[model samples]
Target: MRFDSVPMPTAVQARPRDSRGYPVPAITPWEGAEPQFALTDYGRSADCARGRLCSVCNELMPRGPVWRVVGGTESAAIAEALEAGRPYRNLAPTMEGPGHRACMLYASMVCPYLARPNARRGRTADGESELTSHLVRGTARGGRGAVVGFADYEFAITATQVLFRFLDVVEFLPHADADEHLGDLEAELARRQPR
Candidate 1:
């Protein structure tokens, strides 16, 4: 199947400044949550640079699908931790930290399942009917209160498929207002096509 390029929708604009009127970075099209693969130390040119595949399950394990959790009341504290490169863990509902006042970025990847056409019900372990794989990305969540931002991508096809499927099932939080932006991107892509 041929893939189409979809420009990110930009319904949400960046904040101008806080009560102090300082400059704030404008939000970009890539700020939304997406699936991503982990990058190895070898960099993109290396074969394994995309990340490692599990031999047991034939799953790709990438570094992320990070969640950036910003502390509503203490945005500065969260920013400081991110800059310092401090490690944090993922705890559903709320991600705790050494400092309750700080924000958090939770990163993780979803597993992929490839179903076999001939697989029969109850024939496999756990009644499994498909092969599973992994996708990774480095996630960072930053904002204030419970509001957060997520950014990710899938470097491998196996991972990408899983992410798309997941999106199909679950509604993305924040419900980005990208209708107009998406319309423009679609038009741009059509213009660029070879025809």
Candidate 2:
């Protein structure tokens, strides 16, 4: 007796969702990076949660909530801007974006290199003393260091990392205190870092 050939059906699971029941979008599948010499690879950004994907997970931020990760001395300036009722609409000197608290915590625990000081290494067009004075006094203005809020933001994928250009400052609300958050992050980094 000859048996008939039949294909088996595969079981599929439903995608994950947040507490609100909105579908959670997955990160775009990696197609493998191109060789450096062959061609440049500027990563692409996807719009999500009225913002953009988190830099680490590439997942859309949850609606109505966001997290800002500050890695510099501009926290005081940002707080001052928010306090003084400034109408500034750019977070240029900031490396923050919409993110889940868990994701941010995981990144802080895992990435030790990011915890290092990242001051501009060399002299700028204004000369060494100018940059040194700025670093020393922490009075350098504009870019990520000066801006507090943005009306909207443009996300970019560069050769090395994701960028958020906060534009059109209508209002700025600092969700977390910079000094406390930085101290917490530093403590966590110290604990997590390999000796």
Candidate 3:
């Protein structure tokens, strides 16, 4: 609940102001790589206002449990765990930030790779899907808004969502899907696995 892992950057230290005392542009914690997907136009408010914008609704990510989609190699692991209905805890995987539950649910419903079996199974021009999909939940590391980096997080899983701690790290591994609602995910995985 408390995010003591990474100290919040002071206003002068992180969000410097101009002559008018207006906050300058806010920089994302992920300086190296940007999230490939953009669910909302004002998602940057999470970085600029630090908790005033929701990644899903383009509103504020709110001060409570926020749901963020996962990418990267860890996404594959989390995706597998989700399909298998396994309990994933203390897994500090990287994420963009939080969003409203309604907004996130909408994403899960419309997202091609996340919701559609065909899109998830279809290969791209290079003969691969070229996308890793995951849905994770998180809370502010210490404050009421977003976090600055991945290291400032801890992870947990529930039947409905995956909750993250403010700060913690863990290894990622592949998982399986046992949910029947996933459609042909299992069959699709079987088809993709190397013989």
Best by lDDT: 2
Worst 10 residues of 3 by lDDT: 139-148
What candidate 2 gets wrong by more than 4 Å, as runs, is 1-41, 44-51, 91-97, 116-152, 156-163, 167-195
TM-score ranking from best candidate downward: 2, 3, 1
Residues 1-195, model 1: lDDT tens digits: 001132311211122333333212121111133212121111221222234332111124344332222222233443444557653222212211110000111010000111111212221111111321111121222222222322332222332221111001011122112121333335534554566
The alpha-carbon deviation from the true structure for residue 14 of candidate 1, after best TM-score superposition, in angstroms, is 23
Report the C-alpha lDDT of model 2 over 18-132, residue by residue, as the tens digit.
Answer: 3433222233222343111111123323333234655334555544434443434554555666579764444453323444443444332222212223322222222233212
> Per-prediction TM-score, please?
0.18, 0.38, 0.34
- Write one digit per residue (lDDT tens) for candidate 3, span 1-195: 111221222221234443433222232222233332322123353242354454444444434454443333345544455578774432443333444433333333334343332334232111112121333222111111111122333433333232334332232222121122123322433453568
- Ten consecutive residues with minimal summed lDDT in candidate 2? 3-12
Q: Give lDDT per model, in order.
A: 0.22, 0.36, 0.33
